[model samples]
Target: MNRRLSFSLILAAALSACARQPQLDDPVARGQRDFQGLGCIKCHQIGGEGHAWGPDLTLVGFRKQPAWLDLWLKNPHAWNAKTIMPNFNLRDDTRADLVAYLSAQKGQAWTVYPWRTAQAKALPSVERGKLIFNMAGCVACHGQDGFGGYPNNNVVGGLIPSLTNVSDGYGRADLHAKIQYGQISSPADPSKPKPLIYMPKWGDQLKPDEIDAVGDYLFSLKPKPAPGSAAASDDF
Candidate 1:
């Protein structure tokens, strides 16, 4: 009887493993459907229509990894305590398909995070960026270290992320865009751009090198030790 039970369990385990793997018809489209059917489009616009309650996903594929997105879609609250995005426990098959779809629309990953060579040496600066943070009056709202301060005057949006740990949300390219534009993916309606409290279009104000310098600096600011978390600071 024990042997029969063990055999049954082994078969079940084998079947589960097989189920996890896709037959591989580019599961991305299936995932895209899941993205839509699951009602993500209601707030976060994807191929247009849904518009932009969230960042434009037009080029999201260029930004995140499949495995990362898959995990995120499954559970966002687990990662960031403040994200307004909802977690959709999408089936594994649909999730794989979504990753594939996004990948298809993705921009050049290396351009944003060139991991090799001479140009690659141009990593953003955390030290110099601190000075820029205060000088630019980013401290008025985002607070020192760019951690995003308390919303004193109806200014702080409840769902906004705390910069105390921002490096995790965006890629190097995403950082570049924020520092250059002060907004995420140019707003659909320029007349009503309020990504974060009346962010003035600084694209024209900052110069080529300063933009690079400031952006690199902003991207470089690593969070000190988060409030009371006893874990040793993450090295990277």
Candidate 2:
């Protein structure tokens, strides 16, 4: 009788242990658990579900590569010191799982997403560009009106370049080419890891006219110099 009781107890404990263990085989499932349990929803919104305190992550998969996402999740401050995002000190496996989950969020759930807005197409070129800049997540890195000061890992000056002075260096054609082809920032230290942030190619995502409109919006951001100043004369 005692042997049977011992066996029953062992069986019960085994079952309890199995119940407590999460499904470790599926990273995406584990990631979803982490997303909720870790309070990521408090700051970021996905598919208009969470709070809007941070940049909307509905299309993060489309904008960011998996490697970049993994690194960012592991240590946000390492990439951007001034970022409001707190580092959770996540384990390697946990960070990978979260990256998998976030990477799956490519904005397909929304029937009327920002990039497909018909109203934007009808607006003036400059106005449409402004809308696209914000909606396409340019504001996240470049800052509002392209007055950029965002930090990037191993990047020169440790911050993304501001677009306010782009016209000084790049003509309309050059600007268009940069936007369409995208740019990979060279690391400040060639020995160190590359910068986490890069310009994603918009050519595949945005129409030709939309790209032109974005150029117009960016050109408009150039600051007007005071009259008779050398900068003013240079602009002429």
lDDT of each: 0.55, 0.84
Compute each candidate's TM-score over C-alphas. 0.38, 0.76
Candidate 1, residues 79-126: lDDT per residue as tens digits? 555667766676766767777776565423224322223443354444
Candidate 2 ranges beyond 4 A from true positions? 1-25, 226-236
> After TM-score superposition, what is the CA distance of residue 23 in candidate 1 from its true location, in Å?
14
Stretches > 4 Å off in candidate 1: 1-24, 107-236
**lDDT tens per residue, model 2, 1-236:** 69999999999999999988777688977987899899999988776677878887777887788988987888888777778899899999899999998888777645666655787677888888987787667888899899999888788788888999888899999999899999888999999988878998888678888889999999999898898888677553
Instruction: Specify the highest-lDDT model's number.
Output: 2
* Candidate 2 least-lDDT 10 residues: 107-116
Against the true structure, whose TM-score is highest? 2
